[model samples]
Target: MALFSIQDICKSYPGVQAAQNVSFEIDEGEIVGFLGKNGAGKSTIIRILAGVEQPDSGTISMYEAPCTFTMAKQAADAGIAVVHQELNDVPLLTVAENMAMGLGYPKKAGILDRRALNARARAALAELHMDVDPNALVGELSVAERRMVMIARALLTDAKLIVLDEPTASLTEREIEELFAVIKRLKSQDVSFLYVSHRLKEITELCDRSLVMRDGHLVADVQMKEIDEDALVALIAGKRKESLTSKRAERTFGDEVLRVEGLDPFYRGSPFDLHVAAGEILGLAGLGGAGRTETIRQILGANPNLGVTCTLNGRNVQITSPKQAWDCGIGLVPEDRRNEGALLNFPITHNITLSSLKLRRSRNWLPFPSTGKEAREAEHQITTLNLKTPSAEESLANLSGGNQQKAILARSLSAGCKVLILDEPTHGVDVDAKTEIYSQIMRLAASGCAIILISSELPELIELADRFMVLSEGKLVASLNGEVSENELLKLCLTANSEMVA
Candidate 1:
């Protein structure tokens, strides 16, 4: 008998059939991959299992016994724990305090025993090979360390099954390896995991078997040993995928469209200097803490104290704020789309036209938004970006992660930007959406937009970037053109020497 199993699960929201007739099973001591596109019912099933949402019709069985849990506490009592992609820890609290929530604090003589609580938290962290101080504030911990604390908290509840949703989304390569090590250690002690991620490489490395979903239906189930990454992507996408390759035709770039100099104090090293030509796609490659994001922030005026000098179209320009950057024709599709890019509560049309509302005004004297013009532009963007939404008036929160990202991209383009900076544009999106986004980016570059692409996925950068600039310790260390290998990029990112690569 399976340790946990669900059958014929169905769920729906107004104007959306979120999930229908979904079924899967996880055996004891098994790590099962829950693979799907952004809106393909994976989240619904996870929520149902965690007791955060009730399925319209379904039966869940644990240890061969039928079980029904209607609330999160009930699910926890039944030995189910879920660690979400967006962490649910109180930043102001210490690690021990966060872990002790809902479990009661240690007490001695009717007084809170802080030492005992810290001891317990320390032991729990040690069990997962996590070296963290229990008294440290949760906010002070790195993303990776905080994730480990979440898992440790789940273990405190004696959970037999745990679900990890995109657990490595914010982790660096070294941090990811450490997480895998912890997962392996826990699996040895018979902890079953339901791992959900858009990254095929993680699933391939960690999961024993994978269940693929499409259109709210279970499409395929395959063992890890029997499937490759391409086959898994094909299963989730519901079609065979061609290779991801750049379709850029050989063309000469025009004069430099954007230039930066003296953006010091960005990371801890030398001053920066860079230039991007019109119709050129320049790729920035680095590991976490390598200053790729800081570089972009400096360019966009997020780091005003950096004293950077910028030039746009051969004219010196001073960008002291994000609004200034926007007015100067520099549009940035930020790294964190949900938090920084899109307004989740707003409608898709609103988000699409938010950065360029001035252009949609009826007249200069009495400035009022032209609803007709806004609708027309939103519809055009929706079609062009292939955004999956019922209508432009639909709430952005209701759309899948991929659609939200596309809407954000639409916002950048709608602003009439001459220089586009896409920071992890395809971070949380699926394989099909990634292909579409790459195509759109190539099209943008072909149309004379200077593009700067920064991605942690080296393969993506290698494919799309015309030239690569590698950053280490906040300094430009190497510049390479032509075909580049992931190994070469990794070496450049890890090395401390500031050697130039021609």
Candidate 2:
């Protein structure tokens, strides 16, 4: 008998059919990879299975016994746990306190048992070989550590089935290795897993079997050994994607549009310099935590005390805030779009026009906004970006991940900035969406937008950038012009990391 299963689950919202007859099962100790394009109904079905959402139709079975989950707690009580992509945690609380949430704190004679609570948290962390202080504040933990903490908290429930959504979105290579090790170890102990990720390589590495979702339907179920990454990508996209590279033959750049000098992205690290000309894409290449995003932040006015000099269009400027950065004709599409860049619950029109509201206002100081103007511009951007949505008034959260990203990009584009910084722009989208985004980026650069693109995928950089800058430990390790290979970039990063550690 299967350890857990959901049969013929169906869910709908407004005009969106989130899940249409989705059915799947996990055997004891099996690791299943869930693959789909954005808005293909992968997450919707997962939510139903994990009790985060109630299916309009369908049934769940555990050990061949029918069951229902109207609330998340009911699923938890049934030994099921879900770790969402965007973590929901209280930063002010300590690691132990955060882990103890929902689950009651340890107590003795009606008094909280702090030692026992810490011990329990420590034990859960130890399961993943995480060396974190249980009493340490969650706010101070790195993203990688915070993810591990969430996983640890889930395990505390003695979960029989675990659902992980984009578990490695922002993790370093080493952190990913540790996580996979823990997953394998847990699987050996008879723990079942449903893993969701856009990176097909990770699916190839860890998943025993794969399930593909398309248009809110369960499309295919195949053993991992029987399918290659290319075939898997094709199955998810419903079509093969050409190489994600610009089709332009030659590129021409104008005068220098943005430059940074003597900026230190890392604490007490050597200062570095960077510049981007109009109509150029400068790719910043590095492994996770190699200061690519940090460097971009510094240029956008992080750590002003470091005496970093930022020059735009040949004039020196002091930018201390994101608002100021925009005022100076600079824009950033942040890596963490959900938290930093997107307004999920709002309408697409609002999100698309948010950064450029000044353009819609009758006057700079006027509270009155031109809704008609905003909608027109939003529609224009939507059509230009090929964003798939019923209308501009549709709520952003209702759209797929790729469309949400498109809305964010539209926000940046409408802002009419000269220098644009894109951090991990294609992090968690399908091949089709990624290709669309790449084409839009190329078009933007052709229209004279100076671009600084940061991507973990070396092939993206090799194909997109006119030149690439490599940073390691916050230092400029290499500046490669002309052609470069993915292996070369990876080797440089690994070798630089080893040398620095030594």
Candidate 3:
């Protein structure tokens, strides 16, 4: 008998069929990888299995016995634990307190056992080869260090079936290796895992079996050895042949759109300077914390001035706020889209017209929105971008990740932006959506919109960028036009930080 089995699970929210007849099983000591694009029901199914939600119709069994439990106590009692993609550590609490919160620690006749709690927390950290002090506040740690704390928490549990949701999404390459090593150790101890991720390469290495989900249905279940990367993509996207648009000749190159000379934004980094031309596509390439985001924020008026001045269309201008930048025909699609770009609770129409409410304004007392105009614009953008939403009135949160991104792009375009800045435009997006986003960027450039592209993925920068610049230690170290070699860009970007140490 399998260790765990979920049969005929079905769940529906207001406008979303989160899961439909989703069935799967996992054997003890086996690692099963779940592959899906965003909104493919991966998280929903895992949540159900972890007892966070009760499915509308389903049967979850352990060892062929029907399992019924509440969300609170059942998860730990049933030996099911989850480590979310986002860290859940409390900033003000020490690592020991956070780790021992629900474990009923530091208690004897209502008295606290401080020494025992610290010792246990220290042991958990030590098991993972982490040397941080157990009494340190979580907020004092870095993103990677916080992730290690989460790992330690999960390991201390008696969890037999663990569901990891995008555990490596924000991890660096070396940290990912450490996590995989830990997983290997756990697998030897006969623990089962349901690993969810969009990274196909990691799936191949970490999973014994793989399951593919599409639109709330389990479409494919097979051994990891049976498929290649291309085949796996075809399975997920439901298409065999796909092509990215080739680079074309520039139709028009207007005057300088936004000029930044000697722009320096100080946030634990060196100073830098650059300019963006109208209808030009400028690419920023560097590893994390290389000041790419800092420079973009400075241009968008979100950074405190170290020493920066700007000119728009040959006229000197001052932009001290985001609204000022918007008035200057600049639109920013922020990296953290959920928090900064889109209003998650609002409908797609609201999100699409947020930056360009002028497009929907009609003749009426108090100047209310004209539904007719909003619908027309929404339909055009939806059809043009191939968004997969039932209607403009559907909540932005109801749409898939790719569709949400497309909606954000539509809003930026509708705002009449002469310059569009995108940070990690394809982050967390699938292959098909990546191609579509690149196409949209090209279309904007063709229509005389200067684009500033910032990305950590080198392949994406090379494939989509017209001209590339490398940032190292917050300094503009190199620039290349037409065709930039990957190796050359890497060498240039790493040289500045390398030189400082020498």
Clash number by candidate, in order: 0, 0, 1
- Please give the ranking of all candidate structures by TM-score, highest first, separated by commas: 2, 1, 3
What global local distance difference test value does model 2 have? 0.84
Model 2 lDDT per residue over 1-502, tens place: 9999888888998887878888888999999999888778877887887788889999999988988988888888887888876678899999999999878899999999999999999999987778999999999886768888998898887789999988787676666787899889889999999999888888999999999998888889999989888888889878785665556669899999998998676864678789999999999877766888778878878778888898899998988888899888899998878778788889999999998888888667887678888989998888766677778899998887667877887798677779999887877676777777788788889999999998877777777888788888778778877677888877777666433210
- Candidate 1, position 315, lDDT: 97
Between prediction 1 and prediction 2, the one with superior TM-score is 2
**Candidate 3 — which pairs collide?**
106-113
lDDT of each: 0.83, 0.84, 0.77
Error of 1 at 429 (Å): 0.4
Q: Between 2 and 3, whose lDDT is larger? A: 2
lDDT of 1 by residue, 1-502 (tens): 7899998999987777878888788888899998888678777788888888899998888987988979878777778888866577898999999999867899999999999999999988877767889999998875557877987887777788989877766566766776788778778988899998888889999999999888788898899999988888889878887876556678678889999988653546578688999989999988776778778888987776767889999999989887898888899988767667778899999999998888888785657778988999999988876677778999998887667878887888777679999888887677777877888788888889999999888888987899998987777889998788899888888896758988
Q: Residue 3 of model 3: what lDDT? A: 92
Per-prediction TM-score = 0.90, 0.91, 0.84
Candidate 1 local Cα displacement, residue 164, angstroms: 1.4
Return the top candidate by lDDT: 2
Scored by Cα lDDT, where does model 3 land? 0.77
